[model samples]
Target: MSDLNPRETVQDALYRAARDLEARGVGYAMRDARRLMTHALGIASDRLTLFLREPLPAEAAGVFTAFCERRAAREPVSRIVEGRLFFGRWFKVTPEVLDPRPETEVLIDQALRFQFGSFLDIGTGSGCIAVTLLAERARANAFVTDISERALKIAEENALAHSVSERARFATSDWFSDVVGQFDLIVSNPPYIRPSEMETLEPEVLKGDPHIALTDFVDGLTGYRQIAAHAEKHLVPGGRVLVEIGPDEAQEVVQLFTDAGLTNCTVYQDFDRRDRVVEAFSTKPSKIG
Candidate 1:
């Protein structure tokens, strides 16, 4: 990085960082540069614009330079900053857990539509889903399970940070193997990328995210299969199951839920209008043979 000019303004630094990122083919370069600047300066994103004309502080300039370099290398801004904003709240993010995403908030909206005192979040990476639910619905509690102990720890920390730890229980479980009892609702944003599709993901995802949280290795349906096989048994009568899915997987996932005797299976789309979440109800056992 070029030495920061003592007289350089925040706007000047931002423009330089954005230009560097753009030259490296990063999409939304200015937006990303601005977010990084806010993070580096420890300022609220909304407050950043007000400081744009002020001289860039030496320390913050150094941090911004490092962040821009990481972005140029195809690192996601979330990974660079080690946090993500989801459902209007900030969650700590690391390579250990899947980065919390805006699309997952679609699942959150679908979930809150139903009345549930408790919910079970399977494959609770980063605890965003469970913690957000508890925070949104004051009386709701949750049991969140993850196969990775490290991921569980991250989730636990999020729950604590959100002041929902007392209302949330954590478990290291493969699907429902270690889970006990039923919940008023069940949810998961499981690894759905097929192995064949893994190579096509953005470099930021492939290089910065843990592969275990991105793909099922064999087929993307593995997690859905496990959920279908056991979800009905883990849901209370009239309870609902909501899981985010690859846009193309809606039909197959709905079929799996139907075959499991989970009725009222329906697909909900994200802001992009892509099929993103499959919701089903556990009213009674009546599978189509």
Candidate 2:
């Protein structure tokens, strides 16, 4: 309402919003402002530069300012935009699910490196992992499970949006409780943050994200332990399990897999050189007593 169209162009509004966001200590302020302006005004950021003398409608300016406020309060851009791009596909995201981070792509890359016919994504959240696998390997069968019904719904919508719904299945379960049969590949990006460390995470993560999907009540390895313990049963012989873990959790997770009798346990680093993923495979078929 502050004369957002005072002979200034959309580019001027963007720069002002970026300055406001920067003043509030929002990371990626310039980038987020540009994206918000593009989304609200329906114009590309590059195009805005060419129309610097064009004025933004009052309504558009109002919406853009509100977006800047939310972002300044540490709300994730994904939540504000209601979607994010993962593996070159747009995925619907919400407060109910953790925003899909680039680090998780390491899991997908690892999965594609192996020969597998079927895959399971435990704690699927927005179904980014499952849908990506299905879309990339058209013949692959994939299933995703989430404890939160709301999260599952978002995942389903994403699967359908990405045109992988037919090849993807959604279920509500606490880990593998309702999963049936064995899969050749099982992957997860489960809650791996320790309770004590949760307080230290960025405000956008600590306040805006769902805590249940970010941390486990115990030592932060609870999900990994459960997955490793039961993976041998839910996975075909020689089937591998891939998981994204906290940077400090790599060694502990590798030990858990080893203790569960999974062989060839290994950890991979992400772009930031953090130990970000763990991979292991079942040694032999074992009957559950």
Candidate 3:
């Protein structure tokens, strides 16, 4: 008993999946169906249209059906694909780690503006930030940390996948607890969503992303405070810190940096014009060895 229609063409299957998604209230139903079809066919997205009139392979149809089921259950596309394209590179995604978002690219851009030979990424999650930085700046190295060992494992895997493993070190620690030495830059896209707001998040995010990677269980400022508390001591003279923040968290994060003795605090906006990254510099003089 074949579950897939033997006479169904690829385009027909895609339309059927899209309609199912729409009927289930999935946003961007057609778009997602197209993407999943490409994945199932193992073809480039642009080539999908060429194969539309061809019969859908039984294996591919089964895979597409499973993907649609997951999507209908509110799993993110990234999760369904088990990876995400971040800063033009693919990083693995899983329930144990936070899915990298486009807004975090603002933090990457801000960090790149500084000529840093080394940096530290707190709460590195999947190591998208640290790995991308190391990849972009071939001469740079990084220390990556995460509170969850499982998340750290994924981060290390991403570092390896990007060929940045040699330039990146991993640690399992909350914030800066296990971090060692100072660096020219510090970056993080920490958990900043408030507990109260967690329930209001989209099902794809609320159900797919790790809770520890999304909220602080308190005021959502806990990660920032933890980072601020030890940032100066771990920063080189005039070193910079760049952190991705919630759209409304710019002022509070700036104050945290200011109070921690960092100077030149500046807020950078994302493509959407929402406050997305906060950068600051340590004013301490170079340490004499």
Candidate 4:
């Protein structure tokens, strides 16, 4: 570890923290170290690099050590830092929600390409998707729903922070149970990870992320089933549904959408070239009960 002398410069502290994290095998060690230092010192990351020779305050050193210990234990950096940047905005995150992932940005891109007056986000953890959409498309009306009240609160806060609260609404719904109106675009990054595979996820996710937001009890496709089954009713004719799915699940999920009467379904890949988001449109309205 770099010398922890109270008189060491801020840059030195960051370097020491980064080295410590790297030795501990933490992913994104350098980035996490910089973030932790910035949080503890109340200095911008860019500035931290320039002040390497500057000594950190004694109290800041203590807080930085605590932050490093948490990160060393595999706690998500977002959780450790209390905020995560997504789609050019910072979102507050806690144990109540899943840390937003870059792969989900694919969903945003897909949404932007489509012509939709209104959007609905199912399982809107942290409201990242809904908030980003509203920020990007100012005229688009959006609603975000999550089964967990805590998650919904975070999403609401995010909406307000991003200045999109008026354009977006929050509701506590289990899928579409309480949603009343039809939307032209319905998007979700639901709990698609299979119960059986939960054990195989990274420690940061399996142990640190919210369990309810990361799983579907039956074969990991339950959320897709509910969304596909109910989407036609909640979506206007020709309205589309876009969802992020696990790799190798695209084919199965596509079939589920087809069986549910959604037509012209297609799977899109994320940056890693893995099958990721699925998009489908309702072709004909099913007979209402």
Candidate models: Cα lDDT each: 0.91, 0.87, 0.89, 0.88
Off by over 4 Å in 3: 1-4, 286-289
Q: List pairs with backbone clashes in candidate 4.
A: 8-54, 8-55, 9-53, 9-54, 9-55, 10-54, 11-52
Best lDDT among the predictions, by candidate number? 1
Off by over 4 Å in 4: 1-3, 285-289
Q: Mark the 10 consecutive residues where model 4 has the least summed lDDT.
A: 1-10
TM-score, predicted candidate 4 vs. hidden true structure = 0.95
Measured with C-alpha atoms, the lDDT of residue 43 in candidate 3 is 93
Question: Top TM-score: which candidate number?
Answer: 1
**Judged by TM-score relative to the true structure, which candidate is superior, 3 or 4?**
3
Off by over 4 Å in 2: 1-3, 43-53, 286-289
- lDDT string for model 2 (147-242, tens) is 999999999999899888988778999988898877899999999998899879999888768999999867899899889878999888888999
As for candidate 3, its clashing pairs are none
Per-residue CA lDDT of model 3 for 231-289, tens digit only, reads 88888988998888999999999999899889999999999999999989999765434
Per-prediction TM-score to the true structure, in the order listed: 0.97, 0.95, 0.96, 0.95
For model 3, give the 10-residue run with minimal summed lDDT: 1-10
- Colliding pairs, model 2: none
Candidate 2's C-alpha lDDT?
Answer: 0.87
